[model samples]
Target: MNGDDLTKEELLSRFLQLEQRVEELEQELTQKNKRIEEQNEQIEELEARLRKYENPHTPPSKRRSATPRSPTSDSDEDDDNVRTDGGTPGRNDGHDPEWRTVSDPDEEVEVTCDCCPECGEDLDESVGVSPRLVEEIPDPQPPVVTRYNRHCYECESCGTATVASHPDCPDEGQFGVNVIAQAALSRYEQRLPYRKIADRFEQLCGLELSGASAWHATERAARAGRCEYEQIRRHIQDADVVHVDETGVKRDGDQAWIWTFRTAEHTLYAVRESRGHDVPAEVLGEDFAGTVVCDGWTAYPAFTSNLQRCWAHLLREAEDVADDHKKGERIHRSLRQMYVGLQAWLETDPTVRERAQMHRSARAELTSLVERSETDGAVATLLGKIEGGLDHWLTFVGEPAVSPTNNAAENALREPVVLRKIIGTLRNDHGMFVHETLLSLLATWRQQGRNPYEELKRVARDNEMISRAQAVPVVEPSG
Candidate 1:
């Protein structure tokens, strides 16, 4: 009814009813405002995630900056080779000379002075001999090509023919085993594609080889060194600890993977169709028990009896989590503390009992952190992962066998990734096998500081394994 037509009592009643309706609408608007604020918080958290870093050591400013890298830098060449070969040290005015063994001295002119400058006469007999070392590698001798001929003879009476087989020559090909193995090294370890390898071979060795021939020779070397490859597999399986990693690859335009199983002394490579648990199972075998150090991959934990989750990966994730959530910094700080605690203890080389004490402190910190009620979203997710994977991270506390990082395996896989980028993809099954075999042997030898060319020569002769100078020794703890 219209307000003008209503009486005083009726108007009062109508005003009261309208006031109540306005109050109801205000309450509903207040509830919706609360929900919208909560939603805004969530949106902010997700937006922060876009700026998180994949590597903990990387700076947030660097990641957030839109500036592109210089055109001169190549992504493939920017990474550390994951090798222990430290670069040459700078020499000052006065420093002790570092000693190194000289394999070949270009020219040893006996630098002896037969004539004394002060005496103005020959004093060969009076001068005492003093020697100083100068090391240099002369220009390499030109690579030469040689061929072997086998003589076949027939006996008149029996009408039978016999031919002599050369130990260094392949039955079906003209190239020697050494050249073939070198070609394999060029392709797998040097990160060269097949065509480039062929070009380099002709330029350096003056040997005219087609791209197909070069690839075939590489495959032949891989096949001949089967025994050496098998030995490497056994070495990895028998070790007390193995670091495992995989990189993306393609075969005939289909996605595939290249896996590396590494120890302190040996490395083994396997190319597989899938990144599932089956690939590692095929390599490490079911029921195989040892410390498997890997990143936060679920497949590793599924099969490992004793696992050491990589702290480096954890650190990376923590950096991202902290950047993206309200309680991220807190969670990341706790992780860093745990990592530093264990890292400090390991560096100290503590006794077994001391290790237990230090680990207890770290575990206590982790437990206290996980119980906090301030986390949500990404930070909360990270906490759950850390809490669930506690045992995996703690395996290295008292055990000398386990390494704290899966970087060794990643290093082993680096060259292969580069090779994949160059070649685009593998052609067929046999090509894939050859790639795996030669890469395993080449990587193993280089890791041990041995000459792969010499190793290949030894394998082609079908000789027993020859001992090479060990760069890193594999010694079992006496307990």
Candidate 2:
């Protein structure tokens, strides 16, 4: 009787302990389920908000134009009545109220003509006569060729020879100014390849421009315009927040990399032999101080004052984790939901513009969710990294004025990426430099709120010593 009683008591105790553990697990599951539901709701609401803000049919802010209103037929009577009141009421002012106009007048001149004085008639033809155009030359002029002969003189004492150096053209060759300008503009602005550009010159200008000559022309332009590239580099250095991305570029039958660094003010890129940290170090440098928002590449972490990891990159990582481990699904869901919350919080409320307030609210909510994720096991692993990076997550909110997304530099990288993909990078280092330098120049010009072609034209025409060409009209032939 004693053995049986003791065995039954032990069995009941074990059963009770298992029941309690099951209850605890059920409660934790319930809490996580509720949090997941709330996050989903937050995402849906935010999506709706984003859609409303991003609706393209929505008109931009309407601004009143400064032009004076034209008097309509209905208003003409009232205006006439006002004028008839002598510019006061009830008196005729002798001015036509209907006559409302603005003027853009050209220079005017008057000349007197004397003819047939005895006949008391003015001459039909005058000394200051209008010219008649009997014929028109559609393709009017040929370029004037200018030559500078460098003289060499040997001094008997030192046996040294000196010659004059022209400032605009490079030392090696006598490529025409138009040829160099055309090559550079074609490569940079038109994004044409060397062979195609040479072909185009041959077809249009009747000049047999070799691809090598075309390449050389562009290289010379890049060298001579080095000062412009330097200016862009300096601007990027001084930028407050820089977005950086790199893409593969081929050069000289070898793999190369093109790294782009850009900000609100400027964009500067370089073609490097390697995709190592040296590229970022060269572009951003060892002592770079500005905030860098980039993907989770180790190269950027060294020099940046603050590192803001790209949310888009994290999303990809989270998805990969979820696919690998089923337990990671919950964390991926949470991240997706959090992105929605961010979108809603950013766009739904126009009144909440304070960075401090936004940061505090986001941190508080994220902190709460993170604390609850401790018991979820493997699902919490990804969440833990995100929670650890919470400070960087709120970096966007820290600057209320700047956009929270790294879209600008990301977009800037896309063109180069496609170009590399299509054209298969550059044939050599010179091609890489030519591509990046011009792309940076154009990108920076657009970023500064100017027309790139217009700027190029102005630079070419006004700075003749540098560009060595007149700004010609860029017109396509009529079909």
Candidate 3:
């Protein structure tokens, strides 16, 4: 009945309407599909981000053993890969025992058979003597503390008073210079808290020192070496190249930073409230003339334009980036290739002047890498850092005095880092002052090849505050 009632035109219109409806539904479905694809891509991106960005300071032993070695990281070209016998584990069969070479025996103890046991015959000095070296420490003796008496006299003629005192003894103080120095050295170098330091002094030196007394002794040592600390700061300023680094420190329930500055002649440590540019400014001063080697910390760039960004830090970051995906691997490998090339360049031409020319050729590739950055990811973030600090990154290649990494500063900072871990924090500003001054002086003295123990003793007994020049070390350099 419907076919009979409807015209041919009406039938055609209904078919057209149905076709239009189908096209509209298809367009709506296509938009929704596009959005779903975009969402999936974003989810994958996030997942990759999560998989990457492992701790930079994580030891290689702690990393996931199941993760394959980065394809770009492996190289068969290393000389270590050349055909060689797999080295046997542990010590070799030819290992010689590290024996002590005795100089002269302190006392000669003779073991002699005065009479022949078998015959009961008297042997008149007939037995030859056999000597054996036995090394031993003498019984613990009372701490040898030498006291010097100082006498004051008054002259009747001019009413003048004078006192005669020993140079190695502290005036008016009961403890000898040695006691003060050793106790202070133990506190800082050994990272012992005052109570432990007091116990150590009491046990080892037979001097009953209270915790407060031990702290006072260290403060005195710090005061004596204040000149040396200042001298080290000046040395860094005048250095041809200086390495700088900062590490976290907790102080009195608050946070602080321990900034380490290393020069050819000295390593100086500073404790400050902030890990900002001001820290370096305090060390290097404004308009620092020397080359600065540092990590990619934002604070460092603010200090000096002549900066050598740490290649090791960058490489580790690259590895972190490469941990998850092909993009990161490509980035890591590309950066690694540049590092290798730069190293080869340095090896071929070790002179400082040759650095600029060596890196001139690689500029374009570096620029390309920097110009291209990821929106949000480890690889992108790392590339962003490199891009932002290209000059700093490449500076070492051109400056021979500047190393490619901040290892020198890092090594110098290790002492205080251990100290922080042990002692936790300085109680107040005075504590910070003592810690910084003594550590800087001790580190500088050690670098200068002076005996830290003896140097410390000499520092404690000085009557007049001396200039660094006046306090010049007389002791010969030692291993």
lDDT of 1 by residue, 239-260 (tens): 8899999887898889888999
TM-score to true structure, per model: 0.69, 0.57, 0.74
Instruction: State candidate 2's TM-score.
Output: 0.57
Candidate 2: regions farther than 4 A off:
1-144, 148-172, 316-333, 343-354, 367-388, 449-479
Lowest-scoring 10 consecutive residues by lDDT in candidate 2? 56-65
List model 3 lDDT by residue over 163-185, tens digit each.
65456556535777777787788
Off by over 4 Å in 1: 1-105, 108-147, 153-162, 463-479
Q: What CA RMSD would candidate 2 show?
A: 20.6
Error of 2 at 273 (Å): 3.2
Report, for every candidate in turn, its global Cα lDDT versus the true structure.
0.76, 0.68, 0.77
Question: Candidate 3's error at 472, in angstroms?
Answer: 23
Residue-level lDDT of model 2, residues 415-451, one tens digit each, is: 6866676677577666777788777777788788987
lDDT of candidate 1?
Answer: 0.76
RMSD of each: 13.3, 20.6, 12.2
